[model samples]
Target: MAMLNQIEAFQPENGASWELYVERLNFYFEANDITSADKKRAILMSVCGPSAFVMIRSLLTPRSLNEVAFEEIVSKVKEHFNSAPSKIVFRIQFHKRSQRLNESITEYVAALRNLSENSNFGNTLDDMLLDLFMIHNRCQIAGSTSNGTNLHKGLSAI
Candidate 1:
């Protein structure tokens, strides 16, 4: 099928590339209305890169494929490759993140967004708080009197 061909062509690489691959695969699935579990599993197996194929194959016993659901297989792959950071680890990195000297605000904000997504905090309020904290701590407003003002005010003064 055309969908399967598309999936096969977009094999995900290990490490940083996995996220992009997952996003693309999800988009394809949604666009094609490929909701069936068996079909999803088949597509996943078909599109898996060499490393992923080897890893998943090793995890499977004689009857594993027949028994495992599509969601479980996907979860196992994600768990192995894209494990979420712990809250402490997330907090430490978040607090430690500083805007580089030459980086634009847009670039810095993008970095923060990437970190926030990977942290999986799953709360908009927490994400807002983190954004506020990063803006307050990392951004330096030119000729700003004090740090007590809101982000908008701080940026306006710049």
Candidate 2:
């Protein structure tokens, strides 16, 4: 139980995923032989940070924390913190993601991949990614113009 005090409060804005935090907490319980459900609940409430604990309290309003089981608290917190974003929201971000001027193709592709994570692109993910990359790359190439003079001059010569 003493060793379990090392568990840090989860801050989603700090880039720590809830899944990873839960995984670590479970492993800590296993290592320290803290199997008591009551203890787990107490530890979770104590270690969940002040803001989250307040939120948890609100989530259980009208219901006493003592009456609520460990699983219930964990489930409620997980639902609120780990809810998935809408697919349309993800797709909008993915579509609006244009490569920055200084960003390399590799970086741009990686950004696209990250943006596409929850996009529900399904089996066409690769196809769509390739198509966007090609289109954007072409635009980047031909998008340049010296008052349209160079392009027009070259075309006139041909």
Candidate 3:
């Protein structure tokens, strides 16, 4: 509980504020041989969720996450996980936004992949990948439909 609180506090409000938190988390993640799936999930979910949202929103902000900043974020996250980021993470995080709601997820996953690749955190990266898959599934299940239909037919399908 205490550790979780500390971790929450460590998260930065924005990219510029994340430098120190990223450094400390990286150190802890590297020093410990993390074997727990839950821990990995927590770390990635906490870091990636806000990060993805921020990166996407940053696109429209006055000062945004440029290529250099994006790469820096990725590097830090990778160091924490201690593995090369998988391509799936890269596809989600770094790819330019698409027309759908998934644009944010894609950018954040790319950041995770970039960071993991530099740092070499396989287990952590794997955990992130798994979580991303689950999250994607949940999103699809929540909003997706089998066929195109108008409001009346859509309601009938439901």
Candidate 4:
């Protein structure tokens, strides 16, 4: 699927507040991947911490970590993580007061890593995927497996 272009101004005009928006967005994300709940929670806490406002900022802005943008985001995330740092407790608790923490930052790096693993959809496809994601909130791509699979056999299976 292709990503949809989302304009900041196009957000609903029914006078929505920060909390409602966050709740709705969270619901959408939760609907997308139930398996990632723990991962999502960990990521959210890691990045956003106590500030509920961060969630709003994330939704309003379309994030892209290109070669140039990647460096900047990395620097910011690293700076945030280094300040307080995550510790291993019985259960993880991302410190809210920790200065500069970014809740979804690790997820960004994980995405980059996943994209990098695809040889056919290499760096070039990486950019295309980002474009597709931004444009449709989904990926648009030709069918192929990252692991070496016989194309003929894979297609035959379908």
Candidate 5:
């Protein structure tokens, strides 16, 4: 079917998302009314590609891929490839990062956003980003000869 053709092979080595690939595969099954367990497993095994296949083989250990149920295989692969990071470590990185010289505001913000992804910022992400941006900018302003009172005052308002 047309939908099935859209499924890209899962390749972790290439930075492809196993989560997204599985999501799309699930969508494919829903769209095409593919309810059979064996058929789903077959399609998954075929589509997951070489790199993932090798990973699956290793993760399964003594048991062959055939010995596992579909859900078990999916669980093992997802856990292996998409394991969550330590929140403290990610938060430290997020806090420690500052804009590099020659980096534009857009690039710096993008980097901050990327670093914050696993920071567990939850509801305070926006406020934290604003605070970091302001502190770094203030430091930059202070290092220059120009008066930064106006910027300091503005930042103090928050």
Candidate 6:
């Protein structure tokens, strides 16, 4: 698969690229049909960067790596990278997100999409609510300065 080829070439940078690494790793696993935990663990350890490899090795020092489950290693990595406080901070930032002055609507929405993906806010209702909030709060019409109005009015005037 094209994605599998990309993952085979991928070398994650420590600290700065963990999220992208996990995302691509998951894609690679799915693409290659690697469902066995042992196989998954083997590939994960092999493909991860040196720093991440060392960290995971240290974390598994007390246990036999061969005996450990894939999910357990994934859990440890997720916990290490996405701590509780950081998740809460992400949530708060997502809730308070706004389009900056001179920012286009497309840019704002793209940013929000990324935040929503990383924040794990998978609820359709929450996504709809955020979309509505952004529309009502940030959808400024040209030559108009109104608040608490429907977006249709702005679109109609365009």
Candidate 1 lDDT tens digits, 4-114: 337543343422545566677878789888988888777777777677777776666555675778778767667766655576786667556777888877776677666
User: Predictions ranked by lDDT, top down?
Assistant: 5, 2, 6, 1, 3, 4
Q: Write model 2 residue lDDT over 72-122, tens digit each, in one string.
A: 887887888666678998898888788798886667768888778778897
lDDT of 3 at 61: 52
For each candidate, give its TM-score against the true structure.
0.58, 0.57, 0.23, 0.18, 0.60, 0.55
Tens digits of per-residue lDDT, candidate 3, 48-93, equal: 5565445434543564333234444455454544453466665544
lDDT of 3: 0.45
Q: Which 10-residue window in model 2 sums to the lowest lDDT?
A: 149-158
The regions of model 4 sitting more than 4 angstroms off are 1-18, 46-158
lDDT of each: 0.64, 0.72, 0.45, 0.35, 0.74, 0.64
Best TM-score among the predictions, by candidate number: 5
TM-score of 5: 0.60
Give the per-residue lDDT of model 5 (tens digit) for 1-158: 55445566787876566677788889988988889877888788887788788888899989977778778888898888667558898898889998799987667768888878777788777667666766787334334423334433433443
lDDT of 3 at 154: 28
**What is the lDDT for 29 in model 1?**
87
* C-alpha root-mean-square deviation, each candidate: 5.2, 9.4, 18.1, 19.7, 6.2, 5.8
TM-score of 3: 0.23
Task: Give me the runs in candidate 3 sitting further than 4 Å from their true place.
Answer: 1-5, 9-16, 35-42, 47-73, 76-158
Q: Give model 6 RMSD, 1 decimal.
A: 5.8
What would you estimate as the lDDT of candidate 1? Answer: 0.64
Model 1 poorest ten-residue lDDT run: 8-17
